[model samples]
Target: MNVDFVDSAAVQDLLDRASGVRTEGGDARIKAITRDLIEAVMRAIVKYDIDESEFWRAITFFQNGAPEFGLIAPGVGIEHFLDLYMDAKDADAGLTGGTPRTIEGPLYVEGAPLVEGEVNLTDDADDTGTLIMNGSVRGPDGEPVGNAIVHVWHANSKGFYSHFDPTGEQTPFNNRRRIRVDSDGRYSFRSRMPNGYSVPPGGATDRLMSTLGRHGNRPAHVHFFIEAPGYRTLTTQINFGDDPFAADDFAFGTREGLLPVPNRQGDSASIAFDFRLQRATTEKDEGFSSRTRATA
Candidate 1:
């Protein structure tokens, strides 16, 4: 019988040479890392007695699922990274807070109907109440922001938005309008005070929230997306004057400056508020639309 010894260095040299082979314009480092990861996964599959077909299926699932990770990043908490970075830059320049920023929800439609002065947003005939929202857009120096476009939308008195409510009518996107501020940077609108709304039952987002043991209810609030040339777009909400959730918004959008003092005179309710926008220096700071049109 003869004992044979293998040259470990020769095998290592072969591996080192194979690792240098380029794939998809990737260098040796990437190729080596890819090979190592593949080997580790294969070893895991063998050790765990995972089904070969299921293993490949899981790989396919992960290949498709990985992009969703980006949603959690820039679209979610990871966006705080950029926010913190910007805050640091502002702090260095001694720019303190004027208005707190909030997440821009995906529901915002582009290019909403533009109106002058005021418009009624309440939809149902049964809904009757005197609610007035008046505000002016301002600059950093507290100067009026002329010609500002203020987009306002909210749920109906029943806590149901138009597009989402199957029982609602067609025209007048319920509680949604784009009003151009006057030369004095003033705008007002009339609508019934909207009720607090819960997230739709049995949806992807709702399911996730339920699994996380979280309630998907947003406090009664009015949604506003204000924009003007040479200014940053401001997306925010003014909580209901007397809602219990005012201090406990599920979205964490409530800020000290966002709370509006309700001024009620007889049967009419009024909210006089002011918004300050950051001046835009670049072409990208122009503005964004506030409407959504469905495709046939």
Candidate 2:
């Protein structure tokens, strides 16, 4: 009688069989993605010879930490990874000349007031140095993209976000607003320089970061999601070059050309930034949807 013990090859074969087929209600795309992930996981399990107890413990950890995936993904560089992948794809497709994209974080809220051209972002008495961000929206060919919608939001000086913080309850969307570019493709806004923020100290996200010997700090920056007809939707952030964590963002979102050097004049700091969007060449590009919002 001949008997063969389980080996790495055997583990891989088992995973292939388990993940190759889609269940009754499982979508094809979901099945395909899970298959690849399951195969990689099997390889890790076999390579590390992870024991049942250890494997289950890790599973339980993730199960508990699932709610903090938004924080965890950025902290673990997964968000940046996706952006890099998209950037590579764009380069391959000759889609160039636009503001560099960055992670959107998890604090976006719907229904910020819509105003034409510009709007003030904050009215807090203690708001830090006033910020005036003015910019023009252009296409890859250097033509202005008129009527573009630019949605902007940022944390307060205390590193808290409107609609998601106790201090913001009194002023929902305090630092959030939507501005439309005029015929000249120009938009501007006034707000205080937002402070950098960190993950909640004892939250699941922070717990995992601690276990992994990592920090959860995001540098001071403002978020923008730009949309226009016949152009790719752009989601990006402008990092302050002078932030202490500018070069060491926990989310790995810092990038060259995305950092703006603020020009301090008198009591107000002003930054002149320009955005160039890629021409829409695909259905997804033509319909630039925000991850925070669903298409009607």
Output the number of the lDDT-best candidate. 2
> What residue pairs are clashing in model 2?
none
TM-score of 1: 0.67
| Count of backbone clashes, every candidate in sequence | 6, 0
Q: Estimate each model's TM-score.
A: 0.67, 0.88
Residue-level lDDT tens digits of model 1 in 1-296: 11111124554455455665543566767877966665565456655777879888766755654533322233224444555566687689776655655545434445567888667766565344678988788888888988789888777767776665656553347677789889988988888877787665664435445766766666777878888888877766788656777776555556677777577775457788888888766665566533233321
For model 2, residues 1-296, the per-residue Cα lDDT tens digits are 11122345775577556775534655778767877887677667766778899999989978988877778889888999999999999899877778898888777777787888567988565446888999899998889999799989888888888776755443777788889889989998998767898998888889888888888888888988899988888888999887888999988889998998778775567889999888788768856445554111
The most accurate candidate by TM-score is 2
lDDT score of residue 38 within candidate 1: 53
